[model samples]
Target: MSEQTFEATRAFIATASAEQVELIAAALRSRRLALRPAPADTTATSTSSLMKIARLGDSVQIARIQPQYLSGLTGTVINTRVTRVDIELDAKSTRKLARAKQTRFEVPAGATSFVIHGVHLNSLDIL
Candidate 1:
């Protein structure tokens, strides 16, 4: 007896005319779905990456005119001998803020005064 073997059948779209092939190629080139996956080793261009870098120490401006009602509302210098400054924010004052919490900083003591301008405590750091 002879041994029998099975084979699976495969099918493909019939080849198109030269003009049709060119048209299909052009259509594929125009659509994102037809684009090949990017090469694995390819890195984003250095120039483009440089554009995304942010300079941490940049000049920012803040206005310091105090409102009439809160004339006495000012930052107090605590533990002058210590390098770090801790500003205690009252819970009642920050309860409305989504990230309502106290903020601390390690700023030079030479600064004449700290400014609290924004709704949050960290906003004072910019000053």
Candidate 2:
């Protein structure tokens, strides 16, 4: 490896915990998956061929995003479109949704609901 890259790797090794390193690995894998072009049928909710049927009022969990607290937060689906779902987070989970940390989308402080793409959702109580 180049000297700069070697040094960066060394620094990363020194500063990153096991879980942090795993998160980095998972990100790389997710990125790789994102680039592949082939996808399954469109009937199921999908952004990158992930097949998890979604419907309004289904309880779901968010995944694969920033502000880690939002990941795995359970919420109820308030609306559904071909590729998007609006979730009204459970009252208990609203505390974990930090408005200041939301970079890609604007959600107000103490907001209880947010829209997410279907690929990022995992059906908790799918029907």
Candidate 3:
């Protein structure tokens, strides 16, 4: 992500409402519970080809990119798409989001969602 987009995302999370955060947390938990380990297949060509899939509610640590103020932050995966993952950050990460910028704007009171793209998949380590 670019510096500008990262800043915007951080701002959004920082100003999110408590209810929103709770909802995201719940979703993550639900997803985590639903995950099932893939069955082993003798027909499979390569074991290494079997990717480590990240389901919802999985605990994850994201690597920080320099020039972005926040260092690596841990969070729960709330949602997933073809190319992006939505995460509900933990309290410490949320605080970092709040402090990412000097100026603040009024954000509607609700849930805060953050996205990390597939290109940065290497930065995401599932716990």
Candidate 4:
């Protein structure tokens, strides 16, 4: 980290209120999932693996999603592109997300679908 940036961060923390500090801390906790670069050693996904998980109508579990609380929710694949999947979350899952994100985030009316990147989905377990 650069000295100027380091100093600025320190100065902000030095004067920030407890709530502000906590919010910053929470961001730090989720930074890895927000942007964790792959190492050079890792290889790209194979075609077969993609087929298994990227097929339309497959059931999938949400993982490493932003807002973090959305992780573990289950949904069904409604559409699939090259690297993104449009999922229609179950009614129960929609209700759970709505309640959890009501204050911190906007929950649009009749919002039950989400487009998730293939990489962010931890599992595409067939049901």
The number of the candidate with the highest TM-score is: 4
The 10 consecutive residues of candidate 2 with the worst lDDT sum are 118-127
What TM-score fits each model?
0.17, 0.43, 0.43, 0.45
Residues 53-126, model 1: lDDT tens digits: 11123222212323322222334322211112233223322232213232343323344434332322212233
When sorted by TM-score, best at the front, the candidate numbers are: 4, 3, 2, 1
lDDT for each candidate structure: 0.30, 0.60, 0.57, 0.60
List all candidate RMSDs to the true structure.
24.2, 14.7, 16.8, 14.4
Alpha-carbon shift of residue 46 in model 2 (angstroms): 19
lDDT of 4: 0.60
Tens-digit lDDT track of model 3 for 1-127: 9999989967987887754555455455556644644466556544322223456688887764443553476788877643246677776666666556634322223425443333243456788
Worst 10 residues of 3 by lDDT: 102-111
- Per-residue CA lDDT of model 2 for 1-127, tens digit only, reads 8999989987997899754554455455656666776556556555563345455677777776555656777788776543456777775566556433556555666666655444343333343
Q: Point out the higher-scoring one by lDDT: 3 or 4.
A: 4
Return the clash pairs for model 2, or none. none
* Of 1 and 3, the candidate ranking higher by lDDT: 3
